[model samples]
Target: MANFTELINKHIIVIGGGAAGFFAAINAAEMHPGIKVTILEKSNKLLAKVRISGGGRCNVTNHCFEINELVKNYPRGSKELKQVFSRFNVSDTIAWFKKRGVDLKTEPDNRMFPDADSSETIIDCFMYQVKKNNIAIKLNEEVLNIIRNPKPETQNPKLEVQTTRESYSADAVICSSGGHNNAKNYNFIQKTGHTISELIPSLFTINLPGNNIKELMGLSVQNATVRVEKTKHQYTGPVLITHWGLSGPAVLKLSAFAAKDFFDRDYNANILINWTGDLNSELVSSELTSWMKEKSLIVNTPLYEIPKRLWAFLVDKADIPDNKPWNELSKKHLNKLAQVLTNDSYNMKGKTTFKEEFVTSGGVNLKEIDFKTMQSKIMPNLYFCGEVLDVDGITGGFNFQNAWSTAFVAASSV
Candidate 1:
């Protein structure tokens, strides 16, 4: 708990050169003008995630302004983020970027991206801020350990960061090192006595190996309900048939919320898809019954706004003759068709990372960190932000929003 005067001329070290790292370093230096801030990145490239996020557009933040509604997008750290967002929420993020001359545009789904439609716009903004603040960025310098220097009870402790090539000492250390898929990668933070949660993959697409659905790749339904069979997890949104399996916003959201469950099942589970979103068995039956009065071929008359190709596939799956007139459809075939439309089942054998956005559901346990300051409870002068903590959201700009908010808190605190 150093006062403002005590922090004058102090140094701060930020590990990770990704979205959170750059953000923390730049803000820390900008907030306390006398402090020297340095960023240590293990990778050669900086802002790697920011470069590929939102298919290269860099989803900056969600357009959601209400903290209550905005926090819903997060599956892991929604509770903690309630307090965090109160300090720096989506509106703050929008204003922060706008103040820097980067205007963000909202998509139909509320994902906010730079109006320029390029991630480079974000990278350029960060680089400009870094240079403006004189923040030092060292690439390929992997941080291996962080040691807190013993101090008198009256004074705040200092931190010494041990890295691959050399060591650096700082008045405070911000561990915005992003997330790692493997638990062992968090050994450095664990050595400092913070608990690392069981890491599991989140936000992935369901993989159906050897399934006929792959043949209908590139087809998508505007509205479909995908549910993990035998589990209560389900989401209704656009569902896409990919060459690998099923993907889309609904699948990605399901994967995020059920990450631990999917990991427990070893990614082997049955996913029931309702191509007709919100349509129950009775409703589907009614739709099929109403179509019986028509003389057109069943495949030729796609209903419920379903794509023609998918309608044909569903008709074939029900074993009904594609060319059979709707009026000549059998009772048994009608039941089968209703079932196929309302309750299509697929066995998911595995999962594919949703695009290049690899988000995980576990990290340093949230209980050990103060959301208000993004500072570690166990280690003095040590802070954490971004996915390094157990905070993640479903695809959109939510994860990035978490990064900005938590990084802002950590920077302002330091």
Candidate 2:
């Protein structure tokens, strides 16, 4: 109770009620007992992304532990996050939630979600922790501007925050408003003397409208290597054929790693897919030769691990007769089939957001913030975290882990 008296006058304002905002607010309150921490959310909802992430399962973080390897998952902020993650990595995230009575389980792909398999489990934990910490929440209180006292010689240099409804002053300020595609949404942050990086949508599904692959909708390949033609970018994993275009882990990774490229290309690009996951032309020719020696109907015998329906589709695309047997399949026809199987190409005209978890590839320039403390270099006592910091990761739990790491660091400094 004595310590409470020391922090009675300390006020901290955290803007945004998303994962990072709540994490910062709760951690700050818990760390500085009796300190007044208030969360100002622009929207009426709290943890909206948390509720819709992983299809309502809330992907908390990845299972990676090594700081070096963990940082690689982020397309941006890899160098900066290395040291930051070393302080609060994946192991720490799991322990943090476990300490709050929320157990998380890792999937085969390393995505960590609550054991209850519902986002509500994680949400309830955050809400409970915030309540226990006595954190103040102001819904619909959108922050319009942040005015920090210019004169340090002044007695009390409190940061002034203008909201949609009223105004508030704080000893420290945290901007965790998440990411935005439009640059205009960052006007408030810019007003605080920070330059924003160019924002572009990432982790989106490719749009191949009117393509023949749409007929293969619902067909999924276990392992396919997709490469954007003329670029060094490529990804290997499961690829899902959708009514609109291609999706799944591989496509999403490609989307994230090549977000800027896709934006620059106007989403118009040709993607080459190795359907069999064995791109070696020699191996593919050898496999075709082995299939030809089988003394069975070529159409009846599906080659490799590709699904029968897709195999038939490829064969048809290769113009091979359905009634032909192995011996009847001419050299040209066999080569065509092999080429079609190993080198399928499609055009991507656009992209669609991957569910409700739309992450932007840009935010406040990393140079403007001290990663060690998440404090702005230009403005004292001003901190930034989450997607608003130009740090985004590929599909999985990497992005949320960034939020947790940055938010914890910022809150600890406060």
Candidate 3:
């Protein structure tokens, strides 16, 4: 048996060419210039997630400087990530990309994007790093499974990566193949003796049966709150009422926090909306009263502030005649209207995935690995990074940050 220092000449194989896969491969090769590093990607393309992230603008990271705030964004593993995040975070991500000639800009919401305003910059940055390091990327080579033995030669616990065409071996293997929701990812990780938590679709839009929310299409409230009561989960962010149903940062964040619960409940649940962001009942009441007093004789659908059309929809839902003057509003009628505007609730039947940046909530449990080195606890000469081991973040630029941070750590350790 050879010691760790003696195995520096061994070849390392990284599976999955998404954010983590590429980061790991580049970092590994950069650390050990002589060690051969290769990426075996199942798909024909590399960094497919980065290509579509943030609507093609590629949110690189959030602007939050505090480690606690950054950790809070993750619904799962936030506590465990606190330590890891302290080492590498948004600032580090910015610096890493910046050093590579990829400068990023922040939006009003604190989401950082490349100066190019296109995902091309991200793909270019990664491709440049991979090429410059002379790291090998084998596309169309889907990793079918891993062969883990209690005993072995070469690097004990050898990994036999099988694709459709051929099988390959490596001294060290990092599974950055994404999540279990994708069948290939599930099969790949399951072969390694890791158990996956109940997998389900997350970060999705809520779709009620037959488009029950279709009536409220194209309505967006910049400040709104969403709640899925089953899990007592509440999310506050920009809300957009699309043709399908409620969607936006708030809805998406809510979906993520309630992902496992929703799945456990058969994806059947109720959604509570504070559309006006009226957290204070007295304030909402006084405001409505002021509006009524100012436009006592006004009928014609509530006007400015609230979209007249949506106002009429709310009034109609409250069973108040649309043409009824504000002066004629009875106490019961006002309360009913307030309920619709401030606390309107809906039945969420199921979830619809966001095609741009979808992520899984569970993976090689963090407890089973070392965040400092991204190395597997059970297997020596093995490492994990990216989406393969469960860590996920919100829609902005968090996922990319995870890829970059974990990759940085793994690279330094290697």
Segments in model 1 whose C-alpha atoms lie over 4 Å from true places:
1-5, 151-155
For candidate 3, the lDDT comes to 0.77
TM-score of each candidate?
Answer: 0.94, 0.94, 0.89
Record all residue pairs in model 2 with backbone atoms less than 3 Å apart, i.e. clashing.
none
* TM-score between model 2 and native: 0.94
Per-residue alpha-carbon lDDT of candidate 2 for residues 276-377, written as tens digits (9 for 90 to 100) = 875776678777887765667777777667878888888888898888888777888888887888778898998998886788889999999998899999
What are the per-residue Cα lDDT tens digits for candidate 1 across 105-173?
Answer: 999988999999999999999999999998888999989999888563627787889999999988889
lDDT tens string, model 3, 113-178? 999999999888889988898888898888777775537554666666777778777777877877
Global fold similarity of model 1 (TM-score):
0.94
Candidate maximizing lDDT: 1
Candidate 1 lDDT score relative to the true structure: 0.90
Tell me the deviation in Å of residue 135 in model 1.
1.8
Q: Give me the displacement of residue 300 in model 2, in angstroms.
A: 2.3
Stretches of candidate 3 exceeding 4 Å from the true structure: 1-8, 148-169, 210-213, 290-304
